[model samples]
Target chain A: MTIDALEQRLTDLAFDRPDAGRVTARVLSLARKRRRRAVARLGALAAATLLIAAAVVYFVPAADAVLADTPIAGDLLRSAGLTGAGNRVTAVGAVASSSGFRLQLVGAYADSTRTVLLLRANPAILPLGPPSLDPQLSDQFGRTYHVQSELTDSRTGQVIIEFEALAWPDALTGARIALKVTTLKRACASAPFCTDPVSSEPMVRGSWTLRATVGVDESTPLALPAPAHLGPATFNFTSVRSSLATIGIEMSVKGATFDDLQQRVADGRKGTPVFTIDLFAPNGDTATASYSLGEDQRGPLIQFLGYRFGPGNYRLHISYRGSDVDRLLTVP
Target chain B: MEAALTLSDAATAALTPDELCRRYAPSVCRFAGMIAGSSSDADDLAQDALLRAVRAIHSYDPSKGSPEAWLWRIVVNAGRDSARRRERTRWIVERLAFTAPRESESVEAAVLARLRDADLHAQLRLLPHRDKTLLALRYGVGLDTAEVGAAVGLSTDSTGKAIRRALARLRARLEVTRP
Candidate 1:
């Protein structure tokens, strides 16, 4: 069956008119304390289910076997500042580390922190569209993340964030991030929806450029190709704390394309941006650097990251710059 | 001084609460019914929705369409809020037991009915829930810009912009899915 037809069928499932009943005393009763009680019961049930599952996992040998019992297995993910509530057996989130002096470290450079978060899928959830050859499935990862890039009042220090799940628990593997833009259209002025280039909407006109990057110890900074419009928008970042390790991530707009800007982005050549961030370990050895695109359009940029960390407190950071055809990289 | 039954109703034509409730009740009930599953919850949802409509009535713009469509908007918004709560509760449970309401019969019914009430509702649901609600009220419920703004708790101008954006998405989805 065609997808449009499939969508129609799915949409129809929610079309029933269930409220044929009159508001008699009985109906009122149903609306009364009953709904509140039902909702409360649902909440309680959710709590009870979680507690019981935790109990089972605690007592079952299989749980231990699947988790941390094996050599080079689940043990001391704690050292990398890793922890998890349950096996979450199947997960897809990326544990990112940054150079934020929030942990114990005998590391190389940049303050360091390591953190892991979990995200999962809702069985009823539907993707806005079909998956592509390299579809960005951030939502399905064991944890979902939110991204934000902020230029401090100083206009120098960028506090870019790769937010993990509300209560994520894991360790750093690499700095994973994603970006997407869709539903671009031209507004017809005369008719408000004229698709003709002559009549497309001005509001929808002009190409958009976006960029992000991370640098060590608040060192790297981007050379803005053009001026930017700043605002009071707050960047909220969520994370689940694990070991004493700390990880930091930073993002910023580097630049945009002018002619057919939207077209370039859709073509996937708006230039796959890069991340320049430093990684640190607790020990004084093995400090490293990483980027989003190793060289060119090599692979899927979603959560594909590089890393370096050692014993002790770890912190890391990512910095980037992107604009139309002009791509620039820097570290403060 | 006697209040005159003789007084022209228009001068004091504001509808009695009961009259207002009666007039818009069925559409609200229908909307809630489709959204909440069981006509039972729909009945309750409709009443609760009306109560909210009354409290927020001053915010309504007469320049918009008639009050009936506005009431349907209220019922839809109320039902959605209730569904989100239900989903969240289900989420907590699934996390613990690894079982969820999305697996249940009634929940499935609720999702289907809630999203397919009108041609536009079905179309919007295929896009995203946020887009669905935004468009269903603007076009399916046939609210004017001002009314749509009030219904969505957005500014009148913003409501139009939102509907436009949603329409763009709908077109894109259609284009991609075209055989």
Candidate 2:
């Protein structure tokens, strides 16, 4: 039997549809009963109990990396001045301390258009569950770098964040940058499987002011052939921008109007464009690159893979629903 | 006080419990029914799921998932809870009975009977609860990848990949059992 046949059989099992009206009535009745029960319980408790517990203060020594963990990439360590001869520190206020938690900026590495911040958080207060890291970097010139991705390893409490600095100036010799963090608590001893793991309450919040000097590694942009027209917009292959951690496509969108799209976006009515671009390796293996709206807010934004591809031929496929365009690119 | 009441009423009117039930009760019931196996159990489970969802609505964060996805998750969990509590669950028996045809079965039942057997049924039955719920929610209740992912605690990419893998395994098994 074919896969479609199996799917058909699976779908057919639900043919005898349950009664919506009956179910709804029963649900409403049950809900009303539960609400009444909850209210009655609350009323009974109001008349009976008073309990308080003394707050206790706990302290744990901060975990610091004396020698850079070799598990960290060499390029990252060097860029942050954590490694190499005549190590110059570019990180502003490298360590941020807060109630029951301390986050250290282990290193900061920048390429042509992106920056990666490797941070370690020590949740010394409560038993650590999964933790989330929110890192915000802004320069004195009122330019804020967009955090492209924030990846956290719960086991080690290490966070690797990649932010786009494409819109920043050519040189960041002595720019004062502020980094703010809002850490969320994911797991506690109780209710780990609850619907809202990281709710409104943050585990800890801290901000640091720092002076940063980015040593840029200039990357040559690759030229591409003429634009490929797909649906309403004309897709132009502009350049291949390579950073320390990612390989990306820099392209523009034109011909199709984004006036209405911009309006919807401004009104918070629309997000995440319908189009997607994927990169496929020569051997039929596919790797999907996370994309974001262009820094310039123009067309053909950034479609970048987290890591650089090995020396090989790859196909960049631009697709909208079913229709697509393929471009062969060779990584030198 | 009147203004506050009016605002509260307007908010309640926006997504009333009755409105939510009307919009999603059928799918919820169908999802429960598919997992529960019998009509009576499905009906009871659907009510229980909806009630649980409503009670937890105050805590429902839209940032986490859509309401429908959240409701389906409850149904899936409730179905599993029932299964664990009952030694010989009706759904387990129904799953085995579904494949083998009885005397003078209906036309649809006969069609299914021709396609499935005890061996194939056993393989399908042996699948993990999450896999079964994934298939049921995607096909039986007609939830999209994102919705199914939200319901089953998987990302969209993972959900799509899982469905493909499960389908491939089932197809391969069916091919092996083909007469």
Per-candidate DockQ values are 0.11, 0.20
Q: After superposing candidate 1, which stretches have Cα over 4 Å from the reference?
A: A1-15, A19-332, B1-11, B33-44, B51-77, B86-123, B171-179
lDDT: worst 10-residue window of model 1 chain B: B1-10
lDDT, residue A285, candidate 2: 46
Best model number under lDDT: 2
Docking class of 1: incorrect
- For A159-256, candidate 2 gives per-residue lDDT tens digits of 55666653445344544555676554432212233322334563544444334545644444555744544444566767775433345676777644
Once superposed on the true structure, which residue ranges of model 2 sit more than 4 Å away at CA?
Answer: A1-70, A73-93, A124-134, A140-142, A166-178, A182-202, A206-213, A231-233, A254-274, A281-288, A293-306, B1-179
TM-score of 1: 0.27
How much is the lDDT of residue A315 in candidate 2? 60
True contacts kept of each: 0.26, 0.54
Root-mean-square deviation (CA) per prediction: 27.2, 22.4
Best of the candidates, TM-score: 2
Model 1, A182-268: lDDT tens digits are 312211113322222225332221221121211112112223222111111111112212211233333222222212112212224
lDDT of 1 by residue, B130-159 (tens): 555665455444457787677667889888
Q: What are the clashing pairs of model 2?
A: A92-A210, A253-A299
